[model samples]
Target: MTIEQVWAQYRQSLKAFLHTKVASPNDVDDLLQDVLLKTHLAIENLHKPTSVKAWLFQIAHNTVIDYYRKNGIHSNAQQEITWYNEAERNIKKELAQCIKPFIQQLPEQSAYLLEVIELEGKSQKQLADEMGLSYSTLKSQVQKARKELHGVFNACCQYDIDKHGNLIEYHQQATKGKCSPNHMDCTPGVRKKSDDKYAHCSKG
Candidate 1:
């Protein structure tokens, strides 16, 4: 079959597979285009036309891996800290607001841990003590929670950071309602009173 014909048959299935792995509809569209482009360019190299379905999916799978790999590099590059001006601080706060919903969507224990440690500005050691857990165990849990939280955020938006590790920009994809706050569980009382302003924050 021709490339166009093959793509027509498999595009919907590929997109469905991508949606499960990708949190953003925009990214899924972009990745589908990437798969199409690669398939078109590499089709000449395929010796077996009967294997086109497997070949197309292999390209798609690798494309997803490459997407995360590039983002992972950017994430690591943002480890360094730098001073922020007023504009940068405002942007950071805005990004923080967008993040709150994703944190709330985590498992109850993880959500609670992030809400207390992050939004409430409580120290991990203090939380460990309050929860009657050893410092090492609490630390490990916190790391896992943070990692899961990062995954949720990464799937929703693409972040841009400067050389000094400052967040400069972000692009939200077309995945609406995925990050909406569960207001019943995400009430202001769940956070410290000092953090009330950040409560009920939406992706808007």
Candidate 2:
């Protein structure tokens, strides 16, 4: 997307998110603008950014940190800021919003399995034991379910993958604007994701 489009879509949201971290209106504006410029410049340099919303917020996040650092704020005081915690929640919220639609579109078995494994946090080993299958067999079944979920996702949006089978970028189908990035950390289970936003839904 062009810088203008991104700015129009996200400028106010960025400001609101920044306000939760930075108090001054002027500073928030400055940080938001900095986020725009940084995003514009770094878009090409960074590993291909799949989620523009997440990418912009992360820049805003670092801008907040840099703002604190430049002001010579004590590390202890900086640690008190809670934007990152909120940011993490927002991303996971987006994940929940975006993934379920695709999941529901899957075949019933695939959909149910994904719900149990990824959404319901069921233990694959225990599930396998209950079904009289080995752990490896359950893992394979879960993997196959995730693969079907990935297929449903791709049917809605085109994705670009890097050499190592990592998700690099994506373009959403215009009709599917409600679909947000999965942010699955390349693992579609109930496992917690690290801050690696770009690698979700990899072929690996």
lDDT of each: 0.55, 0.54
Candidate 2's residue-wise lDDT over 28-91, tens digit each? 8667655643443344333444566666676676567656644444445345544433433333
Q: Residue 133 deviation, candidate 2, in Å?
A: 2.6
Residue pairs in steric clash, candidate 2? none
lDDT of 1 by residue, 74-173 (tens): 2221222122121221222333454467787799999999888755656677788899998789879987997887676555544453543233334443
- Candidate 2 error regions (>4 Å): 1-94, 161-204
Q: Which ten residues in a row have the lowest lDDT in candidate 2?
A: 184-193
Q: In candidate 1, which residue pairs clash?
A: none
Position 142, candidate 2: lDDT: 70
Q: Tell me, what's the RMSD of every candidate?
A: 19.0, 15.8
Error of 2 at 7 (Å): 16
Provide the global lDDT of candidate 1 against the true structure. 0.55
Measured with C-alpha atoms, the lDDT of residue 196 in candidate 2 is: 24
